[model samples]
Target: MRMLRTTLDHVRLRDKMLLLYFLCVFIPVVLTNLIFYHVTSQNVKEQRMQDISRALEQIKIEFYREFEDAMEISSILYIDHQLNELLELAYPHPADYIAAYDSYLRHMLNNTYSPVYHSVGGITIYTDNPTLLNSGGINLIDERVKSLPWYSKIPPGRQSKPIFVRTGDGTGEQQHPFSLIRRMNYFYSQNGHEKILKIELRMSSIREIFHNLNLQGSLFLLNERGEIEYTTDPKVDTNAKAVAYNELQLPKDTIEFKTNYVLMNSLNGWSIVAAMPEDEVLYEMQTSRNFVLLLTCANMLLPTLIIIWITRSLNVRIHRILKHMKKVKNQRFELIPGTVSRDEIGQLTGEFNRMTLKIKRLINDVYVADIQRKNVEIQRRHAQLNALHSQINPHFLFNALETIRMRSLMKREDETAHIIHNMARIFRNSLVWNKDRVTLREELELISCFLEIQQYRFGERIGHEVQAQPEDLDYLLPKMVVLTLVENASIHGIEPLKHGGRIEIHFELRAGRLILTVRDNGVGMSVKQVQRLYNYMQRQEEMGERIGLQNVIYRLKLYYGSRFELNIRSALGEGTEIRIMIPADRE
Candidate 1:
């Protein structure tokens, strides 16, 4: 059993379906045909038996009718007073008596008894009247008649009742006849004048009643004692040793003896045994059975072929899906061909196709996005370096310094060297723009340098303070992100104010994110301007204003993706506060 299970484990779905169809369809059909043939066989046996039984009953009626006719004749003869008187009367001579008796006998036999009963072969009468003449139909009573075997069959007190006898070796050249014998007494004479009447019947005439019955099997007529009285089959043993009824082992509705025929009993205690050889009955059934089997096999064949076709179709579709799945496993995401049907498998195929397309799109989106992200990071670093390099352009610097420092330093010679040295330090730090990120301490130093120069420019009017934890000063941030916010406060917020405002810068870590806020009490913008700046920073759709803040927002987005958050809050006549949040990376 384990081996069988193991073997079956390797069998594919197609083969399993084929095996299931054979068990579910073919085997049942074969069994049904066998059952039907068996039932048909039994019905055939019973129907044949019924037919033979009916024929046997008809033959019985004919036998009884023959005897009934003989009895009627005896009744007529017993009541005939004239004939009785003529036989009893004394005659002058034997010739005169012979003429009277012969005349009466000829008229009775030829015109009355014989004409009425066609089965009667002959009628004979014997009387003890010595004067009566003997003729063809009449006989003189012999003294030895008392010793005949038929004499013992007559009832002692039954003078008019008939009795049947099978006469053996009779006084004629013909075969043995079945006779009816009775005593005749017309009048109650004091001497009790008695006569014997015998009516003979031809066996051929009785057998002729059933001769033309169209039957294939043997038909039997049994007596009341279950003896085989007569049969259409001459080969049957009809001796004195009677064949018992029960020994035949006949079939009722079911044929127990497949090889033997059946004997059925009739209403008259006589069994009508009709039997055909089992081979012959089965032979007839076999022909019909073969026809039925052919039809059954033909019927089963069509569905089996249909099942095979259906299984093959399913196999094709399923195999195609499996093959496509194999390719998907190998990372080749391709849509499978859709089926025209709306069944489950077809729906599954459609879903698979949709899933493959979705996966491909996701993969492509991720791949392209990664490439673009790397390119943006490179551009951000290069643009920051270029901006730093362009800040110290010799032509612009030389012209600006020549014009501003020559005039301003002559007026304020004390602040001139301090501003130049701070400017130089800021420029020197900005020049090292190749690094993608800087420590918060270095960023703070750059902010301080710019703020000190701003103090030189707007000493007491513009003031600033920096508050940060020493531990937070070592944290990393994108290069120039903090410095840009400080520069923007000094140039845009404080420069525009008539009374320059103070700038407060705070850096801290909150919940593993960097919090940087730059608040200034400067000439703050209106809500509309703030909204426009916010929109530019968030959406990057408006490109013409606040280029510094926009550049800071864009760089932060590029460096940290969406993990950073920036917001600005300001109002007319109020200071602006820019708050930035970034992931706290402390290396």
Candidate 2:
């Protein structure tokens, strides 16, 4: 039973635990969501419906205000005495009546509509004989007007009864192509007889009014027959009052939408109705809803995430502490950042810091002891190297001197004496083996001895030249550097050639660099051997021991680092050229 429970616990760890933790936090949130759906949505819906009703009332008020202004302007043609006489003259003598007509027009447009109504296309005063008066005139009578549904509704004579007509202006605004018209009885005295004149009104001037209303949801202007006389939209099924209001027997007199909108037509003659969308009505509420959602989601999710993160962070820190303790058991002194506070984590890190410090002190003592031992070993090895070198140098010098003495005793003395003197000089330089550095002049003298010995062995078969600037001789250089190079050329390079070869050593200073080159006309190395020499130079830097070429490379790097370069160019039959560059030394 215990094992089964432990296995189950293990299976429930990690992501499973994290998911369960999130679910535990989610339960209350789900319940709250349910409560919100029950309580708040009802209140929100009611609020939206009430707001939509108020918006519809406001729209009705706006339209009524527009209708009132249009009536007042149309009433002017009936009441204003001078304007009527001007319109009569402007009709027949349209060209000659400019000043009178202009004054009439300026007055006609000014009082026609409210400032909010910019849709006044033009105001027309039509007389009993179809005489039309218009400002900014384009004839409203077009072929399409004869075919309009409202055009045939006009009575035979311009009667006193109120009549409405929709006549197109011939321009291609399909929905707004038609203008609203009203006919009224005009009464005046002419030649002392009672003259009954007919007056006509075209409310194309209201087009600008429709342009401003927001028309997205539902906008309709109804006639008394429940027919849509003029609407912002054409497809509103003007005669079907059922579609606009969802009721059969629509009101010729009332304003209502979905039992919410309640603005009735205040004027029985002509009225315009607009139904503002529910979304547009309560646009401000939508922003409040979004803000609530964001604020609620953040308030809920933040704490849950922080709690889960804290637990996971604690687990990570514990794992680091365990790993550090394991490393300590194995006796490693390493720096690990401690938990840097007085909290539980901080206390654990403090203990770890003490352990690491103690381990470091113990390691330091052991390291110092080991260093002393290494220094002693290095001193012993250096002593052995010095003793071996001392024996080797004298042995070589004694043999070379004895060979020169024998040669002198046998026959030649001049060149052999010179060779012996060079040998003595080489011996004198080698005695300063305690010093790691020597002058280039000393190394060149050593090279002279080495070459003299080689020349003696090879005779005229080997030939060489040395060209050096005088300033280059006193430069500090590694001891025996020139001797090793000359020995390498003579032993490995020249001696291998059948007829022997010429070697040249030249030194120059160019462009902040000291350049020394050695060229040989002997049998040269293959590409593979050249690569191996390059590898030998590299290995000495990685490992501090040098067998041959590595020693020269080490000495150059020890002094110059990146400021030195050794480049070798060689081909099988064409021989070899080695160029060494060192940065010009100031001190």
lDDT leader: 1
lDDT of each: 0.72, 0.59
The parts of candidate 2 lying over 4 Å away from their true place are 1-271, 275-282, 286-290, 293-344, 387-392, 395-413, 448-477, 495-500, 506-517, 526-572, 577-587
**Cα lDDT of model 2 by residue, 233-300, tens digit:** 55455433234333334334433342212333224644445555556654555665665567568667
Question: RMSD per prediction, one decimal?
Answer: 17.7, 16.9
Q: Tell me the tens digit of each residue's lDDT in model 1 across 1-587.
A: 99999999999998899798989988888888888878886777566556555655566566667767877787788778877776567677988876786678678855677777888877878777777667776777786667766777778864566666655433464353567788876576544546788888767786686474544555665555665555666666554455754566544432221111123211234344555555544555677678778979897999899998988878889898899999999999877765456877788899889889998888887998899999998886677546634543233454454556567667877578567766666656655646668899988888887898888888777988899999788889987787888888888789887675899999989999989999998777788887876775557342223347776776676678679888889877787899999999977
How well does candidate 1 match the true structure in TM-score terms? 0.46
Q: Work out the TM-score per prediction.
A: 0.46, 0.46
Q: What local lDDT score does residue 112 receive in model 1, on the 0 to 100 scale?
A: 76
| lDDT at position 414, candidate 1 | 55
Best-matching candidate per TM-score: 1
Candidate 2 minimal-lDDT segment of 10 residues: 191-200
Determine the C-alpha RMSD for candidate 1 after optimal superposition of all C-alphas: 17.7
